[model samples]
Target: MSGRFQAAAPKAPSTLEKITKSPLFTVGLNTAYFVAGIAFIQSPLMEMLVPQL
Candidate 1:
């Protein structure tokens, strides 16, 4: 019971794997960061253009 309660380790790719897939890796990483920052980071230009409600 106690042993089974432990959490699983996080699985992720190695640095080489990310570098080998450079274009996709960087684009995906940047896109994810940008989207996550949208709500926190304000941009007057963008707000003016789109007119936030």
Candidate 2:
């Protein structure tokens, strides 16, 4: 525990963090999720596994 070089604590969010939390980020995230959901539901593997799908 002596002479250990510890990293400093995290600072406040930067401009990049502010941009990431913007509405554009929310829309992008939601769109990505929607596309992934569609892909999962329409995948041939899912159809084969469910059989009744």
Candidate 3:
């Protein structure tokens, strides 16, 4: 490929890469996920899905 027409190498993190490694992003994300998990366990869905729950 000619220099002018060649694709440029990736110089920065893509959207998914940025999100996966972000500290502030994960802090809230992890907290919310944990909270949601707790709520899910206490919800009727848990009993219906896992009869032993």
Candidate 4:
């Protein structure tokens, strides 16, 4: 009975490598996500409070 658990090696990077390499890209992504999230949260409340015209 000789069974040992071995950890797998880490995988290599793919296309996402460029985003991680640039600070501007990350900032832009964060900003877009923030704006989108705000819009998402507001849309439902707006529809509920405002009558359809």
Best by lDDT: 2
- lDDT, candidate 2, 1-53, per-residue tens: 79989999989999999989899999999999999999999999787888563
lDDT of the structure predicted as candidate 3: 0.89
TM-score, cand. 1: 0.35
Candidate 1 per-residue C-alpha lDDT over 1-53 given as tens digits, one digit per residue, 9 for 90 to 100: 56676778987989898696889888888988998789545766566777557
Model 1: residues with Cα > 4 Å off, grouped in runs: 1-21, 41-53
Worst 10 residues of 3 by lDDT: 1-10
Instruction: List the lowest-lDDT window of 10 residues for candidate 2.
Output: 44-53
TM-score, per-candidate, Cα-based:
0.35, 0.59, 0.51, 0.46
Tens-digit lDDT track of model 4 for 1-53: 35977779998777689667789888988999999989977887767877779
In model 1, the number of clashes is: 0
Ranking of candidates on TM-score, top first? 2, 3, 4, 1
- The lDDT-based order of candidates, best leading, equals 2, 3, 4, 1
Stretches of candidate 3 off by over 4 Å are 1-22
| Better by TM-score, candidate 2 or 1 | 2
Please, what are the lDDT tens digits per residue for candidate 3 over residues 1-53? 45577678979989998988999888999899999999999999898897563
Clashing pairs in 1: none
lDDT of each: 0.78, 0.92, 0.89, 0.84
